[model samples]
Target chain A: MTKKLMKGSEAIGEAAVQAGCHLFFGYPITPQNEIPEYMSMRLPQVGGTFVQAESEVAASNMLYGAAGSGERVMTSSSSPGISLMAEAISYLAGAELPVVIVNIMRGGPGLGGILPSQSDYFQATKGTAHGDFRLLVLAPWSVQEAANLVQDAFDLADYYRNPVLILGDGLIGQMMEPVEFADSREPIKVLPPKTWAATGHNGSKPRSVINSLFLDPEELERHNFHLKEKYDRMERDEVRYEAHGLDTDYDVLIVAYGTVARVCLTALEELAEEGVKVAMVRPVSLFPYPSAAVREAAAGAKAVLVVELSMGQMIEDVRLAVGRSKPIHFLNRVGGMLISPDAVIDKIRAIEDGSSEEVRHA
Target chain B: MLETVFSRPDALRDVTTHYCPGCTHGTIHRLIAEVLDELGVRERTVGVAPVGCAVLAYNYFETDFHEASHGRAPAVATGIKRARPDLVVFAYQGDGDLASIGMAEIVHCANRGEKVTVVFVNNAIYGMTGGQMAPTTMPGQVATTCPLGRDVDMAGHPIRVSEMLSTLRTPAFVARASVHTPLLAVNAKEMLRRAFSYQVAGRCFSLVEILSTCPTNWGIPPAEATTWLEKNMLPYYPLGVFKTPERGSREPLPLEG
Candidate 1:
């Protein structure tokens, strides 16, 4: 199949449509508006539905309804809009409904700039809402990867009966790039029928109820334990990462993800040309973090440098992965600032020269 | 064989309900169940329950159901109806759920003319949350938060949801009904049947706002609560059809006692 030139947001939308997702309910937010805009135009042509909700709060609930009815549904929003969706996201998790949510992140504590930023890393992986559950968070570094991962996200959500989050930044949503989607109109995996869906009974079966309220203490506990088992299975089977320069000797092992990892790749080539060996581990999944890969790679290096677009949120995971084996240095640019390739190379050199602080505070 | 005239509706489950004694939620649920049975749409009906006294409404109905968060039942109902337009869908909400927290959801769902039905039970005060002040709390009505009776100067006037929703541009079926007496209960059931029939016909958005009694929260006897609702709430919230598809006019048709 020939690669088509497309905007990152549009590519993600088309990928969802090709994955058999015909229902989309979203509200417009900067950096991710293209997704809803594309769906508004694309869905009707394919006999799909696109509803522009009054707010992200309503949009997410609409997703709950659609997902409860056993349809492949999705929504996209920016940082502040995603905060509005937090309540429904938790409800979706507790209800064990399958849905895909895309957060093309912008900066913020509240209504921050519309530029590219990875400040929502913690919000996506740790505290998406006030619940003990977790979203299957996937971080994509490039437009092509974003498209591919979105298709996989739907399958993963259905496979586990959970919500899958595609964590991107403003750059990934707005940038124009060439992406190749699967030509065949087939899903990546054969999912089981949603027997738990709240479609009408038709007198052939018991009434289906989509609910999260377990009033009894023991019953709620049992539900939590049931959810924990699914999360445990994800940790063992879904951890994904790409390791570079780990085969040869390296002084600094860089840990980064999303667009920052793409910058690190460029820095890796530059450092190799300068007779400096630098290995990098780019985590593809943030929740089921590549802890073992970071630990194993850090074991072969002298020190580790963690880079990101926020004030070092992922560094905490890197610290947990490496433990006290190696000194971990942190570097970040927050509030929509992008870290350049030269900046990453300089950080790596500083670590190699022992001039950087032993422990950079997050 | 003995004749059965008052048997349980086929749409209702055999299990017992958790509704408080003297509460009208059971009566309203029974009316809805009867409507589903009469329409012969029980097999393909989906209900969305709110986060109020009727949160467990899903358990009472044999059809498919979704329990939505507080005030989000309309949006959830919209989802179900949009996903499968062939299925009949409705949202069961309360005063606090519909008029207070979920105001935006209900307003937008009606304005969009979504093919769904909504049952708004306005008991004038919060029920499940220990009788707090609701958006529909009557002036000078005592509640947990309004211990000294509701002060209109501070809390403002109660909202008339049916009248407000009827002002929207979309053509819909909007009505306010009361179930304070046996005669009124019969009228309320007819209003509910019409609301569901609108959805069954896929005609337009429909909502039936029923004035109900909360004997426990009102601190009154069940018999006195009926008289109290008629004397106080009925004067403020008159029973009427606020909008209809046939008329397409904003003039309310107030019913005579």
Candidate 2:
């Protein structure tokens, strides 16, 4: 199948429709409104459902209700909207319902400006809701990757019976690239048996209920324990990462993901020309973190430099992976701005030699 | 031989409900089940349970039911209905759930004219959370939170959701009735049946707000509770149908125009 050029957000919408996701619930917000708009046009054509929900809270809850009824459902929003959706996400996670969420991150401590930023890193992986649960978070760097990951997100959500998050940024969302829709196959319907779906007890045994209530402490503990077991199995089988130039004997390594990783790769190539040996490790699954891979790479490097478009959130994960094995440094820019490749190289070089005092014009 | 005292509408769950004695939640639950049985939609309907005292309603409702957090039933119901429009869908919510935290969701759903039914049970006090003041609490009503009597100056006036929602032209049907007495209970049932009929007719946003009693929370006997609902709450939240679209209407009326 030949590929056609497509924007990241457009790819997500197309992939969702092709995957037999009949419902798309979302609210219009900057950086990710394209997904909702695309769905509004396409879903109707396919005889599916598309709704600009009243708010993020309603949208996420809508996803919950749809998923509970044994249908494929999804929602998309940016950072602030995702924050509002946290409560519903937690309920979905608690109930162990399968659903997909797309977070087109923008800069924020409050209502940060709508620009591409990896600032929602912690929030996606950790802040879904106040609970012992993790959303399967996928960080896609390129537009094509973002599109492809939506299909993968649906698969993972169904496979694990949990919420999956496609974490990207505004640039990836807005950037147009080659994407072949003709190459995409019809969705493989691998839905689990509806033993627990709320599809009414017609001819079957009384009825199957979907809920997250545990009145007894012991019962709740058991529920959490089961969820943890599932998570542990996933951690073993689903850890994904990409190593670039790591085999080469490098004095420093750069760790990043999503758009930041793309910028770090460009900067690393520049550092190589200057005779400063550098490598990079990009995590595709942020929740899984690719910790073992990073730790193995860190063992041989003198220092690891982490660069991101946030106030050093993912860097903490890097620190956990390294753990005194090597010195960990951070280069960050906050409030919805991208960190340039030059700044990353400068940081890496400074850490390598301990002589340079912040390279200029990065 | 024991005659069939239990309705055929009910699923064979022998466990008695956990509702307070003399509360109307059980009556409403039975009514919904009976309607589902009458229409043969029980096999193809999904019900959403909201917070308040009915949080565990999935236990009583034999159909495919999902429980939502406080006030989020409308959104959840929207999801289910949109995902499976062929199936019957309704959300059962109380005063605190539908009138308080979920006010935005209810209003927006009604305004957008979603093709679904809402069975709103309006008991003047918050039943689940230990009798706190609800958005529909009548003036001078005393509860755990408003122990000094509901002061309109301190706690705002009661919200008449039926009237407010009826003003929106998008909804195909909006009505309010009470179940405080046998005669009124019959009216509430008919109102509920009409709301669900609108959904069956594919009309958008049908709602029936039933004035229910919380004798336990209201600190009154069942007789007094019935009398108070008729004398006080009914006057504030008058009972009647607000709007009714034609049987086959599909076009949504613009709320603004």
Candidate 3:
């Protein structure tokens, strides 16, 4: 397929179609509205289904129904919208239904600003909804990756029979980059058996029931335990991360994800030019967080600096990964703001020069 | 061969119901199941079970069931119907789930003319949560939370969901019926069957609200709860077919868009 320049959100819609996604239900929110808008026009042309749901709550539930019925279903939203969809997300996970959700994260503790931020790291990885369940979360650093991961998202969702998330920021969704589209015919079509689908009972079999209710305490506990086992397997087999300059000793190691990883890469080049050795570990899969990789990288570095566009949300995860083996630092800007490469480089130099004291707060 | 009046349809599973004794969820569930069986769409039908007391409906319905959040069943049904136009879809919800937290969802779904069905059971109070006051609670009716009687001045007026939904232009069918007696249950069943039939005919959105009874929540005997719905609840929420577009019925002006 020929490559074309497309915004990250638009690319996601294109990729969803290529992946045989016939249903898109979403409520428009900042930075990612183009995803639903694009589908609203394109899905109809292909005889697909697209709806601007009443609210994020409704959109997510619609995803549950379509996905449960054995269709390729997706919904996209930002921070506040993702929060509203949390309850449904938990239910989808509990039911073990395959679905894909895109979260173009924006700022917030409440109704925060509509610009890009990575403040939802905890919410995405730690399970936004109630109960013990994990969504396969992928963090795309560029528009091209955003498009490609969406296709992979569907495969992973179906393979695991669980919800998958493509976690990006407003910057990734809004920025335009060249992307190679997947061939619509080449993508996998591993539909569940007809007996599993709700496609009216033809003389072949009786009706099928799909539900997530385990009212017995012991039975519910066993189900939860099995969920933990599945998450554990996903953590071990599905973890994806990118490493730069982990071969040599570095004065500072940076941990970042999504668009911030790009900023960190640029900072790494500038620091190398000044004879300061800097390296980074970019997490592509945020949930099965590249903890071992970050810990190994931290083992050789003098200090670890976590860079994000949020107020130290991902930093906590970095601290947990590094433990007390290395001192950790944070560089971030919140409320719809981004940390420039120059600012990150300055923090690196400060830590190197001992000007930045109190390495680990805790 | 003798024909049975109330045997469980092939569309419904043989699982024992989880509903409390004399609770009307079973009757409503049976009505919908029988409708699906009658329409011969049980194999290709999807139903969304809402929160509240009917949360486990997916277990009883032999067809595919998607459990929706409180009051969001219509929206879920919309997704299923839109994605698989060949399939039949419906949502089952309660008063607190639909008229309270889910008001915006059901209202917008009706307005969008989504090809789906909704089976709403309005018993005037929240049953699953131990009998709290609901949006449909009568003006002076007493509930666990409204022990001193609901005050219009303090608690505000009860919302008539059926009346409000009928005001929307897109819906093809909107009716309200009670299931306090066998005769009333039959009438509610007929309304439910018609709603599903409308979906099969590709008419428009259809909804049937059953004036159900929650004996435990009402703090009265099952018989008295039926009496309460007739004496007090029915006056506030008159039972009838508010809108039927198939019969050349249109929603009143100013509210239709």
Residue B103 lDDT, candidate 2, scale 0-100: 98
Cα error, residue B254 of model 3, in Å, equals 23
Candidate 3: give the clashing pairs.
Answer: A200-B43, A200-B44, A201-B43
In candidate 1, what are the lDDT values of residues B1-257, reduced to their tens digit? Answer: 99888999988999999887788998999899999999999989999999999999999998999999999999999888889999899999999999989999999999999999999999999999989999999999999999999999999999999989999889899998987778988888899888889888888999999999999999999999988898899888989888988776458887733
Q: Over the stretch A48-136, how does candidate 2's per-residue lDDT look in tens digits?
A: 98988989999999999999988989899999999999999989999999999999999887897998888888899876788889888
Best by TM-score: 1
| Candidate 1 per-residue C-alpha lDDT over A276-312 given as tens digits, one digit per residue, 9 for 90 to 100 | 9999999999989999999999999999999988887
Per-model interface RMSD values are: 0.6, 0.9, 1.9
Checking candidate 1 for backbone clashes, the offending pairs are none
By DockQ, is 2 or 3 better? 2
**How well does each candidate superpose onto the true structure, as a TM-score?**
0.98, 0.94, 0.93
Q: What lDDT does candidate 2 reach at residue B18? A: 91
- Whichever of 2 and 3 has more TM-score, that candidate is 2
Q: Model 1, residue A145: displacement in angstroms?
A: 0.6
Looking at candidate 3 chain A, the ten consecutive residues that score lowest on lDDT are A186-195
Docking class of 3: medium
Task: Kindly indicate the candidate among 1 and 3 with the higher lDDT.
Answer: 1
Model 1 chain B poorest ten-residue lDDT run: B248-257
lDDT of 3 at B100: 91
